[model samples]
Target: MPDIVDDKSEQCIRFLLDCLDAHRKQHAGDDAPPPPFFLGLNGVQGSGKSTLVSLLKNKLESEPHNLSTAILSIDDFYLPHSAQQALAASHPQNPLVQHRGQPSTHDISLLKSTFNSLKTRHPVALPCYDKSAFAGQGDRTPETTWTRVNGPDQRSIDIIIFEGWCVGFRSLSAVQLESKWSAAVGANMKPAYAGRLGKLELESVTLVNEALRQYDEVTDMLDAFVLIDAEDTQYVYAWRLEQEAALRRERGSGMTDEQVVSFVNGYYPAYELYTEALRRGIFPGVEGRQLVFELGKDRRVKDVKKI
Candidate 1:
């Protein structure tokens, strides 16, 4: 990937900087330093979130708006290798839990503890998950290898970029889930529509939905949010294919086209079930706090709006 600052980064930073300014003003009268501004960035796989994150960190930490920033990724919170294997065994009938892409595959307690510790301005060791471990099934890297922030030698963090593919997903009620699932089945049966949800069993989807409820606690902590929206969700397949193609060319080893499709299949169910709800808006009633970047199939911005 080329190092470029395009419309996505510019619009994202503009909105986030405004939110940071407001965040500082809220603590202007306080005697102590304000806690880090927690911003949630949600996007689908291969949506350039990682690239955008790099640009955001560089801009926030440099120039006149000098501020310390720390990144906390949801990917880093995945369960340990052994625990993930156990989960897969227990839920053998449920393909959603047979892999690590879904909600239940995470160590939520560790994530919550880390979030609470960061709020207190204490030294915190950020978790790291190594995706290459176990032949790409992934595993939590040893704690000794984790990154420590807010230590005496490091500058105090002023911003926390909490980013993930599912950062702002909200759980649905049973009635709502049934309704959505029914609609998906109906739509997919038609020749005009090709949908992923209908390919999944309701029981399998429910298992993931129930596990998602626990994530609401983390969502409540976010001060603001940014969503990189795709015009056609199916575009994710192409985007991911492009990424793997680049990887294979650069390193001479990567997932084959078939493997890439299988990997994305594990994730597309959640995208089908929850992403529309997110697109409607995650920060309801809190106007001007959530920014959305809508992109076309070409991966260029079509519009930037506050939802």
Candidate 2:
């Protein structure tokens, strides 16, 4: 994995150190700064946000300062597995919220509390969701098993790497939402894809935007946002397929290629709806430096630019 970061990790870590220095300055007053500077990393599925963050975390802990850092994945904040079943049942008419990939499925309240505890220097048992559990239906690890931050041996975190597919996503305005569906009409696109879900695609687009409104509570904490962008959306399917293949090889059980395609399709809507805003820096709560990594179809770094 060192080979993976050889190209850009140094520059990335240097940028991180600069952010930390500024953070230290901002908190030089009566109130001490929170131990960790918050960083949000965003990318579509299979776009390597996790890998980039891991590399980033390693460097943050290896410096002359040897900063202690922690990571939180938005996926781990997914609503309880049972709650997922209930959500799907309640929203039978809207398939987008019927599954976990869409924006509305997370328990933002839980995430909010966990993030707050960390920010306030309170003890927290960070929740972990096991996607491999429940016969692959997935479930959250019980509280008993959570890694307790602020434990006797654990150090207070000096950096938080908040990463996810939709980390920096902000909802569009009412008019903007209307314009999307309206534009679809003008482009000879239907308001909704026809199928069992019927208007769910259209309805869910609106639903996701509504859910994103609450996301600012989390994203506002970010002092920096990093984007791991695929060269084209088409790379999503191939990358996801590759991931599924690896999973199968390891466990001898996992989604087939056809299943992988379907799963990735569930997330396709948000990627289509949101990536442009990210590129434009229109997301609210995006402050400090923004970093963009453009990855080629083969998943190699094509370019790294700081904005």
Candidate 3:
């Protein structure tokens, strides 16, 4: 809030702190959950998720909360490039399985163990994924360089800012997928499912929904959830395009424009489905613990509302 992110980050921190303080009051000491007060953040690419986490960490650590905060990202939990290739090979026809953007691409078991260590207040080496590793295909960084959280000096962590594009997403039922799911794509939306590919898309959606069930362990442990929601959700494409353009300017090379479009296609389906679930308050315990910050075309907060 103070050093980075947008002005609305201050407001987000205030709301988040209020929620966290209330949780601590209600469940302190032995009554509290094993993990610290977990705050899950959900946002599309280029929606400032990373910057907001950095600003929130700075603000919380600087404030008088008497807190040691740690960070865990769903991005950091992606399976190594080799494992990802194996997953694709196992399900050759499933579009979702052919890429790293879908729910099944993560190592949920690793994430669970990380959460378990946090729950025990033990020193845990958080996992990190190198987006540029494996010649830009992506892989996990070596364990020695991982951040060791909650050491003797830092003592115990009071909170964890768990964030990613799909942090709090819930799996849909098979009936829901075949029935009302396509409508979740909303108007003016055209995904990869056109003509004959529509059947394969539906099959891919079914497979992806099943894989999402494993993440319930992580989402079930959340004390609070927040969304940096783009008004149309379609803006994710433009937002991510700008991000690639900047990378191109900086390194003079990155994903080609066509490659960027293809990459976005890999994840856009899930965004469409899960955003609808969020709007319906379908995520377990999301009712009062959730807040939405709606952003406009320029990525500025247009409204903040509790769901």
Q: Candidate 2 lDDT (Cα, whole model)? A: 0.77
Clashes of each: 0, 1, 0
Over the stretch 186-293, how does candidate 1's per-residue lDDT look in tens digits? 888888766678877899899889999999999999999999878888888888888889899899999999999888888887888898888888877778889988
Q: lDDT at 133 for candidate 3?
A: 82
Which pairs in model 1 have colliding backbones? Answer: none
| CA displacement after TM-score superposition, residue 86 of candidate 1 (Å) | 0.8
Over 4 Å off, model 2: 1-7, 31-35, 185-200, 282-288
lDDT of each: 0.87, 0.77, 0.79
Please say which candidate is ahead in lDDT: 1 or 2: 1
| TM-score against native, each model | 0.96, 0.89, 0.89
TM-score of predicted structure 3: 0.89
TM-score head-to-head 1 vs 2, winner: 1
RMSD of each: 1.5, 3.3, 3.5
Q: Order of all candidates by lDDT, from best down to worst?
A: 1, 3, 2
Residue 287, candidate 2: alpha-carbon lDDT = 55
Q: In model 1, which regions exceed 4 Å deviation?
A: 2-5
